[model samples]
Target: MLSAAAAADVRFYGGAPRRRRLRPRSCLASPPASGGGCSESESEKARSLLVERYQDGVSKRYTLDGNSKLQVHWERRESAVNTVEEEEDANSLIPQAVKDFVLPAGFPGSVSDDYLEYMLWQLPTNVTGWICHTLVTSTLLKAVGVGSFTGTSAAASAAAIRWVSKDGIGAFGRLFIGGRFGTLFDDDPKKWRMYADFIGSAGSIFELITPLYPGYFLPLASLGNLAKAIGRGFRDPSFRVIQNHFAKSGNLGEVAAKEEVWEVGAQLLGLSIGVLIMDTSGVKSSYSTLVLTWFSVRLLHLWFRYQSLSVLKFRTVNLKRARILVRSHVGHHVVPDYAACNKEENILTWERFLHPQISFGVPMEIMFDGEESNDMVDRLLKLYRNEKYILFVKPSGSRSAAFFVTFKEGATSMSVLRSLWQAHWLHKNLQRQDEVFTWVEESVLALEHGFTDFLKQMEIAGWDHNQIILKVPKEPVLVIEHPDQEV
Candidate 1:
């Protein structure tokens, strides 16, 4: 009878049918050698039987062992790759420029400083002084307007008149409030003197009228002394109380007061000047009044536009606000997962484009645990298993820092190795052995709005039919605008 182990082996290899049949040792034993030729033939038959068994048993076992090793290697490599990918994702979310870097530290200049300097430079010295005086006067006028009109704020009054009004009363209400009970005196010599007295020791009709300058012109002057006072007062207890009151009231009272002041000033100034010119020229005053009205309208337009631009420029350059914006953007890059894995981190550094000469410095390098060489090899093997293409680069010189390897989904190691050989050979032939050992896969073009334009540029550069390899899932692997166009 066959041994139990032999029967088990037979059953494992050939299944139950072979397991049922077993010969006794005496019956299965080979015949004794009779002579040279016959014995050789018997020996050969036994050898052949041994060879068939080894091929079916040992060879299958070896193949299974190899496959298991491959699977183990694949899992190990995938884990490493995933770790690197996660690190990269984390690095992209940091807004290194805004949060980590200090801007305006050396200059000692704030955004307000720059704005003031810019405004001062825009006007002539005399005009600038006049503007400063006007702004000071206007602040007093604004104060007077605030103190006089207790019912509603100016902003509220203006808002109430709009199609989508924001407050109770409108601009017309301000005009009415300022002149209600005929408080606004006629623009005559006697009234001018009275107005001058009310403005304290300034003692000039011009001082009372200074605040009536267009909104744009007023700020240039306002930024100098007027802004300084307002800014300081804004932070003070007294000013805050007034501000809080206006804010709570939706600013209708303040708005109405300023509007009333402006209307009274404009009407008085226009009528007085018109009457004076008409009396001197001996002409009917209608034409002069019309001219004054036209000038007022044009001035108002210019003033509004100027105010809009100034506010826009001021907001754009506000250092504190700009830093906040940069930090938010960089944070998205540093923690891409928190930002929902969007590739926006890749271009988060692009904000520097908005403000050139604003350097944030290089990003900090992330450290990895494994040796780069081993990691690279592991990556290559994984790519091969996936039937992807890979490129391996070895720099020639002793000074070379690193060897680069890149892989894509549809490439093979053999093809990549061939490209590496070509690069090495080219360097050698050109006596550019200094560049030896370095391998590079061509970086793919990133097209923004004009992908078609980039394709056309590639065609013009004689890149027809050249296969371009791209990296992913960072970006699209290939972008072919037209089948005939090369990426």
Candidate 2:
């Protein structure tokens, strides 16, 4: 047996000469447990080892064997397996290089929670729609006498000029449509998205039948391209609104870049498929095949478009959502959240036949019957003296009435929502043939007393009150100079 100094020297200096004396307990391992009653317990040993091992501020991973001996292995600190799975799932089939090029960095994280679901439906839809679009273009070109003559001639010049004029007309149509319905894109993106798709389908139909009426080729082509251009105008704006919705991380620029990349890739794939179809069936392909292919693909596009958009649960309050909320609250005395309202709403509801006709931002001239001294207008102005909006209800031949709400200059999104609720409540009461003055008074009272509670419920339900989706006109804003005064 060695002396205590000799053993200490051997332990610290690896059996060599000791450079200096040091405490034995400072090392990671405790001095081999001596067979004594003072031996450290397993739990106490683990605690001591943990403290000593982690004193450097670096976390070390370890496990104990059945004998309670500390066992450790090093590993890289990286993302959790589930997190990687979530990021890679939707793009699993895409190559890594392609994903890097087209998808935003930290893609799904950079977008909304619904981004993956929307893209899954959008991919297949865009691919098929582009294929159909390509087919229609080819057919329309053939009808317009593309590739028929190599050299330029008088007839060719005339045909070329006509084609150029067709494009010009289409451009004008786009501008007109965009100007007329521009606000709708922001106010109700989903509905406009559907309408744009339908219009595009109609354009395809027009282009499809061009070969049948070659004599009327110019008119048909012009009309087809015009509709298509208008659709494109609406489609792009609506898509921008949706992209804004999806950009959760303030990465709008990145999201837009990735969206363009996806669109280009889809277009390339679709063009390749279109070329395959063109090769398989030559230019002289029958009308039956062309018509059948166009119709089927358009139908598929619309279905997928609907499926993709229906999943988006926008927390904003649009006209349809407002109506749904008001109707539900009035009936059940409980307000549904954005998610519930979205599920109940339809994207393609162009006309609410069962419900009363409701219009927002009616021109002041129409509201006042083009006369400054109208008694009814005076009464309405007096009635809404304390409010930022004026409401007018026109009784119709049917149970349904036309409800119009015109916003004053200083009106806000919240005020617009409140006006909608008030109009809906008034419409409901009037449907029961309640006295008009009495119901109007009750509606105003309900709004004044209960709107704050309504807003609170909306907040609790996670509604984003800041984004009002009401469609008010840009021009002809009605200004109430004396908002505080009675008429």
Candidate 3:
């Protein structure tokens, strides 16, 4: 019964089952005597049993005791060669330190969906822009007479004075430009970025020509420095605002760190190239060569800048984007989304001359010239009594008009958007025979009828209602008592 039980228990777990099981032999109950013929034969039997089990893919072993025990061991086979190959392929050749310096920690996972595309264009734009900027710096320094070392104290003093005065003018220039355009930068960063780049290139041109006018070096170099400073003022803050748009994961710090790394890398490369160019005989000495190279590079820089801005699909509604949506809806009866409007937007604001210019949050005093016409103001107020904003339109040119929107206190983003749509409707339908008041009246009526449905269509088209990019002026809100309203 014991032998039958042992044979029944001898089961294979991994390999195929055998039809017959071997019964425990008497050799399993006793230890084999050392150096004897019986012992040798028993050892051969044990070896043959293990070989058979291994061949069947189920390995087992036995020990000699009165009550013997059986042991079974199984291990999953590992394909180490394939694993090693996979590891090698996944690894990078860049040193860990360099990777840490160049990339944000937790990278692709840490950034927004638009970050990679932004950087793809930004890399070439920064590289080429820095190269041109470096060349401009080299030429400007040469024009300023500080390009090379000098031995004379008077010459050194003059160079020092020139550099200091030029920088002083630039510092003031930056302050003025930054203050003047700060609001516009936040409202329309994309258009301003293009403008800033072009202005910076103009500064480069100014600096490049300074060598020709040796007698007027101070004024020309200062002007160049001033223009470049204005460009920097606008470009830096505009870039910051644009970067903020890409931090969907709230990882602005990581995004900015990686951006700084790219900027520094591009600047270093530009410096290296500038050194090589300077080392070439007659490159810096010849103004024509420098001008030719700078102009060609400046063109490339502008093109890259355009390409970079083109890839950015901002969901926010700025004036240009709002105009696209309104025009599409009003003219074609089709609502376009943020992406479509962004693609249709002109980075240079060329459409500024084509359509009516819209200005938001104009002061009440300025709009009505200090309440000189109370009756007119009251009539206008009653016209838009249902709305939170007031619109005023006037002919700006022979072909174009200017639409000024002044918001009352407690106005919201929706109010501003509604006013924009109404203003656009007025722009499309206003005729020579239509009085400004009558046309505005018709626009208000249309707004009352269609604005809610317009908003629904906008929502359907993927417009972000919460993010209106229009700038609200800090001027005092309008307040005039109406005879018909309760105090």
Q: What TM-scores do the predictions have? A: 0.15, 0.61, 0.62
Candidate 3 has what TM-score?
A: 0.62
The CA lDDT of each predicted structure is 0.29, 0.63, 0.64
Taking the tens digit of each residue's C-alpha lDDT, what string does model 1 give over 291-380? 555456546744553343222211111122223322332233121121221122221132223321121110000011122332333333
lDDT digits (tens) for residues 1-487 of candidate 3? 1222323222221112223344444443321233222255444443211111221122223222222222111211123754564465459686544444445544668668888788679989977875565456545565567545443345544565666678778767677766454456666788888888988888877788877888898898998999998888888989998999988899999999999999999999999988898777777678788778778878998999999999899988876787788778877777887777888888876533536566665533234432333345546766777776788777545566677776665566677778878878888887853366777788889998888888888889988678876644433243333344212
Q: Which residue pairs does candidate 2 place in steric collision?
A: none
Error of 2 at 120 (Å): 39
Total clashing pairs in model 1: 38
What are the RMSD figures for all models against the true structure? 30.9, 28.2, 31.7
Q: How far off is residue 76 in model 2, in Å? A: 78
Among all windows of 10 consecutive residues in model 1, the one with the lowest summed lDDT is 359-368
Judge candidate 2 at residue 26 and give its lDDT. 18
Error of 3 at 386 (Å): 1.5
- Which candidate, 2 or 3, would have the higher lDDT against the true structure? 3
lDDT top scorer: 3
In candidate 2, how many Å is residue 258 off?
A: 1.5
Off by over 4 Å in 1: 1-251, 282-487
Taking the tens digit of each residue's C-alpha lDDT, what string does model 2 give over 1-487? 2124322211111111222232232123222343222235543453211111111112222333334443322222233753575466555788654554445445668778887788789989977985665555544665577633354345545565677667667776676766555546766789888888888888777778888899988899889888888888888889999999889899999999999999899999999987877666543367687667767777888999999999988878877888787777656667898889999888888544437566665533343343333245445556787787777666665657777666665677776778877877776777544345556777888888777777777778777777666644332244443233433
